[model samples]
Target chain A: MDAIRTEALTKHFTVGFWRPRPYLALEALTLQIGHGEVFGFLGPNGAGKTTTLKLLMQLIYPTSGHAEILGRPVGDVEVKRRIGYLPENPYFYDYLTAEELLEYFSALFGHSAAERRRRASALLDEVGIGAERRLQLRKFSKGMLQRVGIAQALINDPEVVFFDEPMSGLDPLGRRHIRELILRLRDRGCTVFFSSHVLSDAEALCSRVAILANGRLVSQGALSEILAVTIRGWELVVSGLTETALAHAQSSAGIRGATRLGPERYALELPMTVPPEHLLAKLVAAGATLVSLNPLHDTLEDFFVRQVAAAPEERGLESTRG
Target chain B: MRAIGHIAVNVFRESVRDKVLYSIVAFAVMLIAVSYLLAQLTAGQDLKIIKDLGLASIATFGLLMAIFIGIGLVWKEVERRSIYGLLTKPIRRWEFILGKYVGLVLTLLVNVAVMTAAFYAVLAYQGWGVDELARRAWPAPPMDPALLSAIALILVELMLVTGIALFFSTFSGPFLSAVLTLGLWVIGHFNTDLRNFENVVESRAAAWLARGLYYALPNFDTFDIKAQVVQGQHVAASYIALSVLYGMVYPALVLTGAVAIFSRRDFK
Candidate 1:
């Protein structure tokens, strides 16, 4: 069953002292997230990713169109019961400890006293906040607070969870832990819909991604499908670069672009037609030692910049010509 | 109903924990104590003075509690964004409003009970004799029909204030709601006077306007049995019953308006 489905869901926010023109934050967005699937919303800043999540969570009303969750209309309490949401830049009560905050939320859900205690403890442990259980949230570090935020989102054992930039403002370890947790949520058969400006995190965590730009969905599919049109190329790193060899390579047709990695070293992007053996021979003849050669894959960062920079209506999943 | 109960219980717990309740109760005790001292300054009408001060403080402090705390009930939920969680629950908006009002009433009831107990305690220690006073001239303490009537009226007055505060909070922020509630309280207190002034107004249009104001605001003075209580007057149970009915109807009207306004709010 589809966990979430939207048909032309649109939301417009009006702002100004007198002349309030509708700023379309979400424009006719239509998509479906399957049960137990990890779907990532990928976009740059101001791409309406967070707005879409807010609409799904019923935190904001759409100006037009509709959405449904678990076969029920969006904003239905039954539908909400099955979903948990973590807002971007969430501001919790500063006076409450992490446990107190969770308990308060649990009460809203009408969780039994026993269930609340058990779940809060388990979630705290899962999010690595069990050690800081006694600490007030106001004194917690940003990373620690984010962990508590995630823990609160998981309190209800929701079948579907929406995370808005959950991995933001985290160190490498914290990022890895969140990525692992997302995987675990998927393993435990929970559908995860998340939004992130960080394409790399989306790439690593999402099974499929939707790319949005200027309040419209530009492209969406499996990572492989999204990047299918990107050009295939090879990377060559030459370590023992003598001036003569560097000069020869700088003037060669086989090396389309060369960037210096360090002193006496250069990383070059080679055309597919040039075999590694021939490149090595050419480098050796030019008085350079070939250190490494490997195939290069386009990262999601490359996809984001190219997609967002294109016209919203003109952009497709296909890669731009190099 | 269960959801309403749940919301009410949590609201009650949170309000009791708030220092506002204790502060109001303490201030009431201090006021009642001051009344005892102030009664000494009045040469011959010590009992009357004490009764006026004690009952008035109860009524005033009860109004403060209702308006101040009741205004924050819904606003706090909105400001904290906790209303999202509640709205997303299987509870109706009316239940939330009713639950909050009920919770605040419970808080006010406890505070009033504590204050009344303290007043009784101080009166007992002061040891005033009621035997010497004329039955109709000066009311007996504890079992005075008028005093009992005043106590009942104070409860009704507090409920009316809570209704007003909740009504304002349905659309306005906490600060504005409190201000409006306080204004309404003042108008309600002088409602009978407004009506009397309307009856004697020279201009027919001015009389109609004042009459409109009199009906529009709560008739708070109708619930002021303090004078009757202090003067040892016999207040019939039927009059008290009728006043209770009036109190019930007015708050119901106010709460109905509150629920309607709150249900339309988007909470975005």
Candidate 2:
């Protein structure tokens, strides 16, 4: 069975007292995440990524359709036992120390006291919060609180984990640490589903990714497949050249542009159709030494930007299959 | 059951950590002490005055704690966004509500116990008098153990009030919940007056409305045995039984309503 599945799940929020107009927060969000895979739900702010996570957690009800986790309905208590969730910008009881909070969460899953203690200690250390376990949560910094939040989420040793904006508001080191932890969960065969606007993290970690724009899924597929924008061409750098030689390379056939690096250096952009052998021969004959040749590959950020920038009508027309 | 217990313990710990709980308890203790000074001015009726004042202070302060803390119980979790971690667990919504209610009730129990102990101590000190000659001139009355019955009844009343506050909190924000719960408490105490007003009014609609309100609102007066206890009158066991039943039944009904509303909330 899929780790998570949603069929046309929708949510509409009402606003204003006098008029009470309905605002569509999520619209027929259909998705499926396979077991033992790291799935990234990518979206910009207000793109319904958090809303979808909330609906699956049963913190809010969907206006239409349904979601299932571990082959059970989203709100099933038994299903929740196998799932752990860390909400975006998580806030816990400030009065509880890290140890107390984790133990309390473990107890919710009916873990024995000894088991709770063992798990809380291990998870606290795992999340890099072992040293701060005795301090109250109120004294924690934003990053520390986030680490503790992850510890609590894992205290139950859940089979599936969901995180909303897991890397949000973290320093580079903290972000790297969380990325490693997520990778560890995946390696342990725990399905990791997280929503993020940070495309780089998604690219670095996710096996499969889905992008949501304005409450609708615009694109989704394996990272390799989705990031496969055909290489437009290659970039060639040549140095130790005279102005006449630079002008020759710039005017060469199939040369897109020549950017000056210095008085003696120029970068030549050539389309894929151009033969590299021909370019090398021209540069060497002109007494221009080759600095380097590098292939230009499109990044996930590039695809994300293209998908996000497309009009709603265009995205709807080209929605990618799972 | 274990989930409820865990949540209840957490709630109790949270409440205990709140400085407001200590502040209110300390203030009530101070008032009980002040009652002793006020009693001296009354001369012949000093014991009666002290007893009445002490019991009244306990009830008043206990009511404030119940309303203030209880109304914020669930609302605080939502405002702080801590409910996300909780509701997403294997626990049910009704268990969350019950756990919070039970925790606050336990906190109030401790508060009432401390105040009651202080009141009894003051009574004991007063009854003993200062010196041998003072004791001969105006001998202090024996400390009555029956005062505990009054304190017990007050606890029952406070539990009901806490339930009302929790019921309001499930759907409303703290300020509005406090207002509605306090309003209900006031109206509940005057339910008898509402019934009398119904009989006196000639307008049928007004009469029926008053009558409906009387039945709809909790009759908090039923929990008061303070007057009798203060005057050294014996309260019947039958009346205690009925009042206890009423207290238990009303809060249970209110809790059921709260859970029903809370279960439907989106926690948005």
Per-prediction TM-score: 0.84, 0.91
lDDT by residue (tens digit), candidate 2, A1-113: 89999999998887767877677777898888999999999988878888899999999999999999999999899998999999889999999999999889999999899
The segments of candidate 1 whose C-alpha lies over 4 angstroms from its true place after superposition are: A17-20, A131-144, A168-173, A236-253, A257-268, A272-295, A311-322, B128-138, B142-149, B193-198, B201-215
> What DockQ does each prediction reach against the true complex?
0.34, 0.76
TM-score of 1: 0.84
What is the alpha-carbon interface RMSD for each candidate? 3.0, 0.6
Displacement of the residue A170 alpha carbon in candidate 1, Å:
4.5
* Model 1, span B1-268: residue lDDT tens: 7667777776777776667678888999999988889877876677677778888889889988888888988888888766754565456788889988888888888888888877776666555454544333444654444565688789988998899898998788999999889988887877888778855778988888888898888988778878777777777888888889989999999999999988766555
**Cα lDDT for residue A153, candidate 2:** 82
Clashing pairs in 1: B139-B232
Instruction: Give model 2's docking category.
Output: medium
The lDDT values for all models are 0.79, 0.87
Point to the candidate with the largest lDDT.
Answer: 2
